[model samples]
Target: MPVIVLEAKDFTSPLFLMRTCAVLSSCTAFSLVASQQSVLEPESNTFRVFCMFTWCFFFILTLLIHILSIIQFHSLIPISWKNLVITVAVLGGLMSFSASVLFPWNVMDRQKVTPRCVAAAVASCLTVLAYASESCVLCIQPHEQRGYMGSTPGLLKILQLWGGCQMIPLIVDVAHGLHGVHAWQLWASGASYSVCVLLSFVTLVVILGDLAGRCLLPFDRFLAGFSLIGVLLYMLATVICFTKILQLRNPGQSSPKIGELFIMETVVSSVTLLAYTVDLAFSIKQLCDRSHM
Candidate 1:
């Protein structure tokens, strides 16, 4: 048979090359636009600022509440284990504020704010450590303390788990930011925040279920209701965080749409602050009730 050969000119053409390049360029442009939009959208920045401010404000409020709790409910203080838990919780709150402030800068331009990021990372580590230590203390209180039984054990364990879960996102965020892993940090932060929210809801359900089984009195019901409010508020915050994550992932789709997510986040944080306040109030009431007995 006769040999037939194909020339390069038959397959290669200027028009074909041009079209391919155009398509690739379009995709690249779209990706860049999307990335820029995600980071620069007014709504996103606004929400970020709002969350930072809110966390800082609540951080101070929590400190004040803890101080008052210490003063007013001195008799209720657990000398050994509970004191450790309170210390962890207080320290965690302080670190949370520092993290919130440093997070925005870390995300915006980590190189310029490396020192701040490092500080934030240290604070986050301390927060996680404190919470984890508190959890351990609560879990092992029975072995170390004399009056560690009944509802106290159960309550301590539940709170320990709750605190531990809350620390997950903070740890993830800190780890990523400190290493300059922006993409991973954002994803991890979102996951951790979501987990905290889910855990909080689960905690609320468990608390209510336990109360239902043991307490039927009106006062007990009131306490349960107050706790439920706190849970609901926290749940709302989780939803807001979820929305923010989604917007961040799909940037440049629409600014108005993304704005809604930011707004939701702000609203949820506000609600969470209120819920925490109410929870503290209920704690005081419980302390009073115990005193009467």
Candidate 2:
């Protein structure tokens, strides 16, 4: 008789423990929110709702992933399991950040902080930490040992996606004040945000689903071109945003929040622009490397 040694990737390994933690914390945090929902203010519910959505969505996703992994379901699919794992880890971390931070803020950032809110906050924070730990474990491994999405360019794509998501909401908020207020410039900025977010999202999906090479266009070249476009659009948007914000500050604007929102948009757009630019540079280098090969 031969004795079998379980691999680290086995369903009974530490990774499963991580997923189990994620599932439990998500459920606890969600239940706490629901338990006291009637007592919370309506205005606060918006943030709480977002928090609930995050918990419910990610919780289900975590369970499904674990179940699938246990049944060897990933083998039935074409997607690279490690690549999918790391990608999910990264995304879950980002999504859970809102649930952890903003949800707690919604519950506790008030004059009266209840015990239910405290418990929920603690659980949500633990949920975020679990996701973060999962991401870190995958990220800290040797470069050659991981999937493409676990690489530098792929991580940048995640940041770009997150930045884009954050901006779209703020842009809509800022647009509310635009009676004719910086109309064309705002439109230009908004367009940049919308388009970049869409492209970045599509790029990530193609890479994760392993469809990049199957597409009609050359993947690297298309990515390089799109990254260049993202850089330009963000540059335009950032410059306009900052210029308008400066204009607002020096002479004052209609509302402080309008200026505040633009300030946030400007910061995120700048960071996203930098990420895209670096990704573009890397893409160009990759193309050159491929050509040489």
Candidate 3:
């Protein structure tokens, strides 16, 4: 008798779906924090607003892909086409994040360029080209060819890579926060900065774990729970941070304006984190049920 071996799970499975959600949730949370920073600084600026809009748009589209994937919606583009779209979306997000970093928060002229901007542009373009080649190669290859990353590299690998790219800007922002942590009069601001650092470490660990071929069943249980706790802590810290920012804003500013800003940030962070937490918990529960059987 011959023994048969099963390939690792692919995009169609619950694990992949949950992993995708986890990546997007992390990105969304970071974007919300960035947007809040932009809002709290000086006057409301168009360039900053555009950057936030771009990132938010990317998050929504990726999330819709997750939903359509779960429902097996046939009306959507073919799987390969969907992959290409996602690749483009992720690249766009990368550009948006880079812009947020390279450009000042309040650039009035769109044509303005500096030495730093030039460097940022060059780096962003190179990144896009590299990822584009990878995405095209991944999409053009048949399932068998995609197997190089491992049988189960699946959509999780792609999503995790994208998530890691999106973190570059957030990481920069965190550096700034850390530098100014001592100057912050509000305790919440300092605490939020600490949480951001912790979250950054968590994201780095996740990226390393996936690349190290540790994204598996029992380990995933731990990753999922760890991620949920990190996100929850970040959200708690963010609410406090935003509330402090609002109170510290210009006294002449309308109360409604400040309240609205706080409300918006809270809602975006809460919704994204809640969705991710639910998905991770669900995936863990399923794993438990199967193990008992």
Candidate 4:
């Protein structure tokens, strides 16, 4: 049964449907994995641990959302209910995406893959689709009525920033391991990533928590300013990654798996750059529109 919305309207909203799907799928994933522990190899417990953590965390948080909405609980919360919902949905989707990839990759190589294990992997993927749908509907379909980071571009920027942060650890590796890269170059690369992450993360906290308008500067200009700086720093980080890091990379000599990791990091960096660039453009446009108004 659908949890009745607090409004007069019946249970017809796509958001509600997606919420239900997310909750159920999350529950199914963790439960399925937990029940069949004997089937999986002991060495492959990392996959089980990660999937269980993602599913359980999502399940608990989403269930809390449903309860909060049903009871109209709002006080003491730092962010708006919808903003919190979107944040959870997007983060949950990312975690589920990771779990889906990790779970299947671990299992597919095993000689004796069980039906139950396959079902658990499928359940993990289902959670991803469910959360992704919820994110799209919340961020795209009715974004204007939502919070600052609720719009399509804004929500996508959050994903981009998160993805970039994930890839930034590769820079840490380069900073430590690069043979020809200078010490100052290593320090600059690491500092660039640190500043970009800290700035972006704090900005997101202010915006999604509805604290942007309360700040001294105009939120639009603040966002635009932040994006501009972020683009520059992210670009600097990418340059260090591709130019300096890759110069030391010897793909022909390294194992194929190690080579693949390098390629994947570079691809993520490129995509992250494009995402931030688009955000910078969008932020500028939004600032201009606000000025005209």
| Every candidate's CA RMSD | 24.3, 4.0, 13.7, 4.8
Worst 10 residues of 4 by lDDT: 252-261
The most accurate candidate by TM-score is 2
Please give the lDDT score for candidate 1.
Answer: 0.42
Q: 1-293 in candidate 3: lDDT tens per residue?
A: 33333235556454344435433543543444463333234343433544555545555655665555455562444334333344444444444444444344333233454444444334433433433443444445576444322223223333334333333334344334342222343344345435544543553445423433555545556556655654565466456546545554556433543344445334434543454455456557767887799
Error of 4 at 16 (Å): 3.0
Ranking by TM-score: 2, 4, 3, 1
Most accurate candidate by lDDT: 2
Q: Clashing residue pairs, candidate 1? A: none
Model 4 TM-score, 2 decimals: 0.75
Q: Candidate 4 lDDT (Cα, whole model)?
A: 0.70
Shift in Å, residue 67, candidate 4: 1.7
**On lDDT, who's better, 3 or 4?**
4
Per-residue lDDT over 1-293 for candidate 2, one digit per residue giving the tens place of the 0 to 100 score = 33343456675666787888988998998898788744455534545666788788889988888777666566667766777788777877877775676555445655558788888888888888888888888888887656887889988888788778767556665566572247888789888989998998788778767887798889988899889999999999888977877677554454554555566678778988999999999999999999999
Extract clashing residue pairs from model 2.
Answer: none
List per-prediction Cα lDDT, in the order shown: 0.42, 0.77, 0.44, 0.70
True lDDT of residue 119, candidate 1:
46
Listed in order, each prediction's TM-score against the native is 0.33, 0.82, 0.40, 0.75
Model 2 TM-score (2 dp): 0.82
